[model samples]
Target: MQESKWWKNAVVYQIYPRSFKDSNGDGIGDLQGIIRKLDYLKELGVDAIWLSPVCRSPQDDNGYDISDYRDIDSMFGSLKDMEELIKEAEERNIRIIMDLVLNHSSDEHLWFIEARKSRENPYHDYYVWRDGTEGLPPNDMRACFGGSAWEWVPELSQYYFHQFSVKQPDLNWENPKLRQEIYDMILWWMEKGVGGFRLDVIDQIAKEPDLKITNNGPRLHEYIRELSKETFRKGDLITVGEAWGANTELAKLYSNPDGSEFSMVFQFEHINLDQQPDKEKWDLAPLDFLKLKQVFAKWQRELYRTGWNSLFWNNHDLPRIVSRWGNDKEYREKSAKMLATLLHGMQGTPYIYQGEELGMTNAEFEIEDYRDIETLNVYHERLEKGYQKEDILNSIHAKGRDNARTPMQWDDSPNAGFSEGTPWIRVNGNYREINAKQEMADKGSVFHYYKKLIGLRKTYEVFADGKFELLLEEDKDIFAYTRTSEGEKLLIICNFHEKEVPFLLPEGWSGKEEILIANYNEIAETEKLRPYEARIYRKA
Candidate 1:
C-alpha cells in the first residue's frame, strides 16, 4: 500500500520461546537464549520473528496465561533482556513481534486476583462472571480446551467465564476499564520499540454485551470494531488476530487500517481440513475436492481483493502439516519442498514454525507422555463420561494441540539439544535424522528451500502484493494460480495428489513457460509436473 511495503516481502519465523534455546541451562528456553540465536535467524533470511508468548505467567497455557502485562516472566529473563533483544534484532534488520494474549490472563494475575476476591470488588467487572443459570454452568458455550466456559470460583461464590482452561479467565471487554488496560499494555510494548504482536484468541475478545447465549453468536464484530478504534492506532505496528470464524468481510472490519485494529486476521478454514465434513451433517465426505478448491480459492481471491488472509498451515496449536497431511516420512524431501513452495507462494506473509523446515513430524509417544493441560483434562473428563480410551486417544490423535508444542529438533543430541537436560516437553522420536543441523548441511534440505522461497519473495516483487488468478478452479487434486503485475507474470502450479497426474494448462497459458523452481525435479520448458511436484514459472 506504500513505497515501503516490506511486509509483502517479509518471511516471519515463529519461535516457541520455551523450546527455542535456553541460556540458563535450566532445561527451559529463555529470552537470553533467543538473543544468542539472532545471528542464525538473520542468516535464515527472515524479515521478522514472531515469539509465541514471553510475558509473566504461571504457564498453564505455557506463557499465554500471562500474569503480568508490564513485567517479563522471571523464567524468560527481565524486561531489560526483552529491550536488549529488540535493539539487537533491529540492528540485524530483523523486527520482533511478541504474542498479545488479550483474551484471558492467569487467574493469578493481579486483576483476576482482585476480581476473584469478592463479587463486590472494584475489579469484579474486569472478567466475565455470572450467577449460574438454572444450577448449570453460565452458558452452553464449549471451551476450546473442553467442557463448559464457566468455572466455579469458590472465592467469588459464583462462576467466572474461561473460554480456555480454568487458570486462564476470559477478560470482559464489556468493561471499559479492562479495554483501557489492554490499550495501555499495547502502548507499553510499542514504547519499548518492539515491532508488533500476534494477538492470541483475539476474536474471542470484545465480547458482545448483547452476545446471545448460543453457539456462533452474532454481533461479536460490532464490539471488536469499536475496540479497534479505542486501541491499535499506531503505524508500523503489524498486529495479526487469531480468528477462526472470520471471513473476508470480517477481515475488512478488523484490518481496514482506516479504522480497524490489526494488520490482518488468521482465517482457519483451510487448516480445518481434518474436519472437512460437518460432523452433524456429513461424514466420509472425501474432503469435497470441489469444496476444497472453493475453500482456498475463495479465501485467496476474496481476502486478497477484500483485505488480507494470514496464510499458514501449521502453528503452535496444530500438528506439523508434513506429518498430518503430507508424506514427510515416505516422500521426505520431495513433500517438504513441495509444501514449502505451495505455502510461501500464497498471497500472505508465510509463517514457518520452528523445526518445520526439517520435515519434522508428530512425536511417537505413549498417551502418558503428553502434558498439555487441556489434553490431560480432556482425557480424564472423557474417561469419566464413559468414552473408551481408544476413542479418547483418537480425539487426541485428531485434535491434540500439544502435538506442535513439542521441543524444536536442533540436533541428534538428547532433548534435541533444545536444552542441556530434560526439556519441559518430550522431543519427537524422529529427532536424530530430522534435526536442524542436518538440514543446514544438506544442499537440498528444506531449510535451504525455505531460504530460496524467502529469497524469491524479496528479489522478485511479483510474488508479493500481486493479483492472484486461480486456474482450473475445479481440479480436485491440483491447486494452480497465477501471480501477475503488469508484464511480469508467475504461475504457481501444485499437485496436491499423491500420484502423478497430467495437468491441463489454462487457456492462453502456454509457449515456453520457464520453470524457476521445481520441487521434484527440473521442469522442461513445456512439460508436466511430477507427483507431489510444484513449479513456479514465468511465461516467455
Candidate 2:
C-alpha cells in the first residue's frame, strides 16, 4: 500500500513449475526443482517469482484444482520442500508469490466433499448448490472450458456451480464462514514467508446467486475489500489479481491509490485484441495495431497516478509471445528482443514468463499430442460435429493454451535437459536451437537483451515511475512512446512489422539524443527502422 513497496520495483518471472525443470527425475518440475534454479533466476535479475498453483490436487486441471490448500502436492514435493524454496529464494532476495485460486476448489477438497454428502451437512453451504436434474441445469451460462456451468449431483438431488470443470466447484463467497476459511488459509501462507499472492480469476470470486451473468457483481468490490482487510493487509504483501474481462475503469476501481484491494490487476485488453469476438480461443483474427496501441496507452495514462499496470506478453495459459506476435521462424531473436524492449520501457512492472527470455516459441504439436483438458474437450466436441481434423489441428496450432505449456528448454541435451525421465508433455522441437544454455553462452542473444532491459528498469527511475505519453499514435508499423519524469525523458521506438519503416522525430526533439539501449548494433542515420528494431533514447 505504501508508495515505495518492494513489488513496485520488481521484474517478476512466472514459473510453471511442471515445465520449469524436473529435479527428482520424475519428469515433472517440483518445489525442489525451483530451489535448484534459484541461482539461475538471480542471475537473470528478476526480483520476484510467481509460481503457479502447487497445492494438493487431482491433476485434473494441473495444480489449479486444489484439494488441500495447506499442503503441497506429492507431485510437487511436500510442504517441507516449499518451505525450503521460500528460505532459499529469500536468501537470493527474490520474493516468492503463490498463485492463490480463490474462485474455486477441487471437488475432492474436504469442504466440497462434505458439502456434497448431504444437504444438512455443516459444510453444505461452502459451495454454490442448486436443486436440479441432469441435462436440466439451473442456468444457461456456459463454463469457460465449455458446456454448462452447473454439474448435477445425484447424492443431494442438486447441481453445483463450476465455471471451469466439473471436478472444480466454485466456492460460495456469500457464506461468512467460507470467506473466513479463505482468509485463514491466506494468513497461513503469509506466515510461511510467502511474499504475496497472484490471485487467480479473483474478480469472479464474488458473484450473484444467478450464474448467468459474468464478473462485476454487486458485491465484488465489497468482498475484495473484506478479504484484503482480513488477510493480506495485516502483513506487507503484494497482490495482483487476474481480472478477466476487466477494462481500465474497472481496473482502477480494483486497485486505486488507496490500495483498497490489490496492488495491481492484470487486464486482458491487450492480450484479447487478436481474438475474434464471441468466438472460442481457437477462432482468431489479426491483431489491430492501432487498437493494441490504444489499449496500452489508455492503461498507462489512466492508471498513471491511481492504479498500476502489470505488463506482460506471455503466461502459462497463453501462446508464446514470439510465436504469436513475432516472426518466430526468421527474425525470432530480433523480434523477441524488440518486444522485450517495448514492454520493459513502459511504466509498469514487467513479468517475464519462463523460456520467454530465451526466445522460446510455440509448440506446434498435433491434436493427439495435447494434454490440456480444455483443448481435448473442444477437440472432441468439434470432431463429433464433423469438423475436419486438419481445421481443428490448425486452430490448436495457432491458439491452443498447450502452445505455452511445453517443457522448458534448459539445454540442447536429451529431453532438452528438462528431466532425466520421460517428460509429461513433449518438448518443443526447436529446443536444440533455442535453449538457455545456448543463449547464456551467446552475448548477442535474447537472454542478454532481457538482462539489459531489466537492468535499465532497475537503474533508471524514468522507466519505472515516469509519466507515459503515447507517440506516433497513428503510425501503423512503428510503436513509439515517451516517459517523462522531472528533467529526464525516455523515447522508445519499436518496429512492429517485418519491413523497414520510416520514423520521423517529434518536433523540438531533434537535439542530441543518447542511445540508451537497442536490439541492433548500428542505428540508421536516415531514421529508417529495420525489421523488428527497437531503440531507447534518453535526454537529460
> Taking the tens digit of each residue's C-alpha lDDT, what string does model 1 give over 1-540?
211345666888898888788787787888899998888788778888899888888888788899998989998899999999999999999999989888888999999889988888889999988875445775577676677777787655688878788888888877878877887777778788878788887777756422533212455566566555555555466668888767778778766645455677878777665553556111112345566667777877776655666667788887777776677667877777787887788777788887787787876566898988767877787789887888677667556766787887888988887888777778777888888788889878888888888888887777766788878877767888888876788888888767877776777667366677777555644456577788788763
Residue pairs clashing, model 1: none
Pairs of residues clashing in candidate 2:
none
For model 2, residues 422-461, the per-residue Cα lDDT tens digits are 9999999989999999988999999999988888888888
Question: Model 1: which ten-residue window has the lowest total lDDT?
Answer: 280-289
Q: Candidate 1: list runs displaced more than 4 Å.
A: 1-5, 118-120, 131-142, 151-158, 208-231, 257-259, 280-289, 377-399, 524-527
Model 1: per-residue Cα lDDT at residue 234: 56
